[model samples]
Target: MDDRNIQYIIQEKFHTLSKSQQKVATFTLKNLQFVGVHSATNVGEKAGVSETTVIRFCYAIGLSGYAQLQREVTMFLFNEGNNSSLQNYLQSKQKLIENPRFYEKTMEKDASRILNISKNLHEEDFNRASLLLHTKKKIFIIGYGSSNLAAQWLYFTLNLLRPKVVLMKLETNEMIRSLQEIDEESVVIILSFHRYFKEPIQLASEIQDKKCEIIGITDSRIAPITKYSTITFVNEQQEMSTIDGMPALISFLNTLIVGMTAQDHDYYEKQRVKYDDFQNSFIADRWS
Candidate 1:
């Protein structure tokens, strides 16, 4: 029990405490966000208290210490923000690595989401993306934060499948500047999820000028979607108990990659032959 997650603990038993303990609770309630990047001193300063008071505040809240408290607090906040069930499964797997129940529950939910998308998989969207994939419009996949890795993965993956696919994960303010290249019929795929991206949403809105279709691979069919989207694919990150886990999204994209690779045999064969040769020679030695 740590004060890092003081907000949750306080919420659980705020009214059952004494006056001094309540003071610390009030401070934490007011500025729980500050705890994310700040130390006890910084939080105390914002809470109108001294460093030692913050330490006592930690104990007062029933946390073992400040550090443990922070980890729990972070997890609580993260779980609260993310609603992806994929995260739920991955975390459960980590927690219950040796348990069969975790895998059983995880695969059930994972299969559900995956099968749902597969059942609802729109051929029209695939056609739209395929049409753009084979064409030339400087395809840009805009993702940031955790999705940056996804964007980069797509960038490389799509390169072997097609060509000239770029993953753009610029600063929030710099998104509009990147939209300069968006012209008539330009393909822009926006990838995002919890915590959502405001800049990409804005860019998608601003992309109305382009004749190109904007494909929104979003968590939902909501704002920050493309104007003339020929197809829309929403990758759902399944969360267990509000945790915005990423495995589902990753699995979805993995399917997308496999689908795209299967659709283009010439590209896949050439890339695979070259890759296997390189992998067996340069990389296989290390693995062996």
Candidate 2:
């Protein structure tokens, strides 16, 4: 068996571990070096659990006994320091201890991933999304928590290209007002990422009930919100130690806008001139 697979196994099974198992798992993941040198009773004391719980945690993570767990940690220390899960932003300490240059490596890794996303993007998905944005009667963009700002920026960009584009605001009445405007003819765009906020899921459900078209921008193809969407854009976002991937999402959004502009040059030019006129009158005067 590949002892190197233990870290990813722990991560993938984290949510399913019992409370006591989680306690042991958390401590073990953060202190693999210590586990390699210590006995089960000593490790248990450091993790604030009993030796039996340590043994149980071992079994829970698919190890036969505490000795195997120690062997795995030893193998991890000698090799396999660059496992992908260690690069995750959520598991901060692991990344630092395993690879001190994780930040720089992550930047290069994430940039390459984003560029590949653009290359692999399906033509049909792009055309369908751009066509809908150009023709929809009203477009409502929804995102909550970390995604709220991205949604707002998208709303602003789309509003400039066409009218009746609204960002779903936080207030209860505003949300109701936005939903009231949604129907079969309307289009909704939802931006959701890892640990996706619940509000967007519920909102997607409501929009699905209206039989409106949904455009889902998320990291996974099987993301919950995709069930309600007519078009789904899966732009994978890999989190670093402290930052979530935003550049990739922005790249996708920019492409969407560019596509729309290309589809209707006359309409876009008309809106651009109007926008310039408003900006010049209201904001440009400060330059003088």
Please report the candidate that would top TM-score against the real structure: 2
TM-score of predicted structure 1: 0.55
Error of 2 at 112 (Å): 1.3
Name the 10 consecutive residues with the lowest summed lDDT in model 2: 236-245
Which portions of model 1 miss their true places by more than 4 Å? 1-101, 172-178, 223-228, 236-245, 274-288
Collision count of model 2: 1
lDDT of 1 by residue, 69-157 (tens): 57766776686677355655455567556666776766776677677667766777766576565564578788776567677777877
Residues forming the 10-long window of minimal summed lDDT in candidate 1: 236-245
> TM-score of predicted model 2?
0.64
